[model samples]
Target: MSFISVNPESDFSIHNLPYGIFSTQANPKPRPGVAIGDYILDLSQVSKLFVGPLMRNEAEEVFNQTTLNKLMSLSYEAWHEARQTIQRLLSKHEGVLRDNSELRSTAFVLQRDATMHLPAQIGDYTDFFSSLEHAINGVKLFVDGDKALFPNWKYSPLGYHGRASSIVVSGSPIRRPNGQMRPIDDRPPVFGPCKLMDFEIEMAFFIGNTPNKNGDIVPIDEAHKHIFGMVLMNDWSARDIQKWEWIPLGPFLSKNLGTTISPWVVTMEALEPFKVVNVVQEPKPFPYLYHADNYNFNVNIAAAIKPDNGEASVVARTNLSHLYWTMKQMLAHHTITGCNLNAGDLMATGTISGPTPDSYGSMLELSWNGTKPLTLSDGSERKFLHDGDEVIFTAHSERDGCRVGFGECRGKLIPALAL
Candidate 1:
């Protein structure tokens, strides 16, 4: 619908104006931008055109920033206004931008010439075990059916605090972590490079601009207002290290090595059309965690692995709807104890796996704890990732011929440092 041509299959269509921070060699300063077809609408160049009352005065300042934190810290109304203004400016009938040849040249940059950066300066991060199939798979691999489903899991969304310092934008290189692990049951633990490096395919959301008071709880109905948007994520893991250290505590160094996320943050407004019925929750949740509306999305998620010299092969496919705990429920439970949340905080749905082997989200589950090896397109077999292996995650939702997507969340594994 825009003056510019957009391919029907392109992830960034007229329907999806995802936001991110980007830079180019000509203008090395990172600034906010929106993805559109094969080009990026440099928000900094078009900031003055945001004439809406809510964004008219503030657009220039926020769009010129190096990170999205300031913009994300705005109210829900402001976010909506900004999106509406952008959509209008890009409309085919909007002569302001479509007819301005000089403005168009400076405002649009080819995507290939721009470098993407983290959308926001994340202050905190949490990863939740929200997928029923993934949880069951873990139980089957490590423990017996007697402890098939942990009793506390059904009551609330269980999660662990994660390190935010190591979180990286997509395309970063992840060096294998070195840690202690008990390789043999009868032998003492040894410290060295990880033997079971894996990737957890996940989808994460950024908290909106408002911050909750330390003693206040976020009601389930209001959780959506506190969420800004979603992105694809790869929570790289060193399974051997995690198994040895996650006894009394959960995920330490094994999880902190590196986490990668897609650059573009697909807004909730763009995904509204893809909303589907929430998964049935037996033993109805407490009032604080219950919501009548559907928060589950039908986003299709998939992960693939590519060797340095080989073609990529998809190893797993799943849907965000597989999550047992909805994002709203997770947020409501997160603040039930009065824990404060700030703008740009991140929360992720952990390992979204479906009920079949092909739908598993992690290498750990896909290979059944390394007992089964997966053969790649080049006939190379992998029980776990090798030094040159690259993990790529993609997610999208489509309905009525419109598609909204999170571009590739990718990372390559490199050799660990020598002790």
Candidate 2:
């Protein structure tokens, strides 16, 4: 409905004006931009268009920054007002931007000519095991038959602190990590390149400018205000190394090697219409982690693998609704002990899996720990990722011909350095 010529099937529709940091060849300085159709609406050039009460004077300064941290630190009301002002300015009926020839030339840049960077400087990252099916699969594959699920898993959301410095924007090359692994049961661990490299399909949210005091907990009802938006993530795993090291302690080098994330961050307001019922929790969590409103989004998440010379083929598909714990619950539980959260912090839903084999989220679950291999269109079989394999993660929700999507989170695995 806008003045732009957006294809109906394009993910960057007027309804989904996702934000990211980008730069062009002429001006190499990174700046904030909003994706629309095939072009990026340069916020730096059109900052004055945000004339809403909340963003009137602040927009020009915030949009000029190289990173999104300052903008994300604003109040939730200010964020909402920014979106409203943008939607109005881009509307077909609005002559302010639609008819301004000089402004249009400066305010819009073709997406293909732009280079993307990380939206914010993430201070910390947390990865949560919130999917019931993925957890059950792990228990079945690795634990004794008597313990179907970990006792603490049902009581609360389980998570681990992740390395923020290693997290990279999509399309970055992932170097296979070298670490010690006990390949044989009784043999001493050997140090070498990872043999079982894998990918984990996930989605993460960036914390807003709102920060809690060190000794105060963010209530479940108020967690939404602290969340800014979501992005697709690929938590690359070194399975053999992880199994050897993760015992009393959780993931370390096996997880920190490199995590890939999509460039654009799809805001909560754009995805509001896709909210669906959450997975039912059996024992029911504590009162502090409960919320009457539905926070689970009905996003269709899928993973595909492409060999260096072959076509991409989808291997797994799942929905965000399958996650047993909501983002609100995760945030509430995270700060229950009075741990603080900052504006650019990230929290991810780990390996979202559903009830079927094809819905599994990671290579460990999809191939049943290498017992069953997946055959691709080129007749190549994969139990784990190869040196030239590229893993791609995508997520989107569509209704009534309208789609809100996080574009591809992609990474190509390369050989590790010689030990």
Candidate 3:
């Protein structure tokens, strides 16, 4: 892996490289780009870079248009092939994109002139609660102590369907939602605005393809074959509204307001250099969910809040290694009953908090179920997000003197509609 000319400290710099869709204001047509220095090398314009067994005459077709939808539709092997090609083209080798002044203008553009779009045309989105620390803290609020953890937690991945339509690309505005929320002392539930809006710092996996059989679940050993990459996700919540309506079903209005995903989809191959072990589990998983080798990989994950008008405060920083279950286990368990997972489908690790207070991934945990108050820099106490507040989630891989990061997941809160 040759070193490319990139900023020493930029989040999108070489050590922190990733892929996404973007284009200038002059050309709104979305195209694939790999982050280098402060600019996005426009792959759509430099189509010749894609060649070889991936495609012969049509090798350049992947970059002909904007949005990774066409490329994302390819098989997992194609995804890896394309990633490797792009990585090489962006590498320190001077012949490709580096020293060629003639191709520089056509190949590179300042990132500021462009807007980042959703990297994939998501087919489906599923969220899994796989963090042991986050689960324990949350469960303790309701159950408390070792009893806080459910007996079956170590056996399977807990998951639920999420709204794909509401999953926004980074930098979009998120409006507060009108829903039912009841004060702890209220007589009954009140039909009004949400007071406890929240941000869930999480990491989600991108599925590249499905199993051979339709409706068949991905097996544990082969789950990585279907995985494309990873991104930071914020499953925004309306905690007060959730409290009132979460009776029989898990989440409805509270969890659906607006979810944000990082623009870059850092490929799994890019993360291979930093794979770490998964969190330790007291009771080993059942046969179907167990893997002989690695159960999960390590990626340093984190979340921070930059008030709409203030400086950034690192509210939480944790690791993907804290996950109780491996992505393979989750995918295998998800499909053991015969559910299908398609290419571009998303699976998330819910609220990836560590064992300490600084790593509390969500306001619900930080505020301790609304009983305690979170003090901010400006002397403001937050039980939940106030209008105009912003939340951001970021992830990266840094070790052995290298770094790779997901840009950011940012959204501002707007006043709830009067409806």
| CA lDDT of each prediction against the hidden true structure | 0.93, 0.93, 0.78
lDDT of 3 by residue, 155-183 (tens): 78998898998999988999999888777
**Listing every candidate in turn, what is its Cα RMSD in Å to the true structure after a full C-alpha superposition?**
0.9, 0.9, 2.2
Tally clashing residue pairs in candidate 1.
1
Give, for candidate 2, the lowest lDDT window spanning 10 residues: 139-148
Error of 3 at 17 (Å): 4.0
Error of 2 at 378 (Å): 0.5
lDDT of 1: 0.93
lDDT for each residue of candidate 2 in 162-240, tens digit (9 for 90 to 100): 9999999999999999999999869999999999999998999999857698999999989999899999999999999
Q: In candidate 2, how many Å is residue 185 off?
A: 1.7
- Cα lDDT tens digits, model 1, 180-204, are 9988869999999999999999999
Please list all clashing residue pairs in model 2, or write none if there are none: 73-209
lDDT of 1 at 306: 93
Compute the lDDT of residue 269 as modeled in candidate 2. 95
How far residue 377's Cα lies from its native spot in candidate 2, in Å, is 0.9
lDDT of 2 at 53: 85
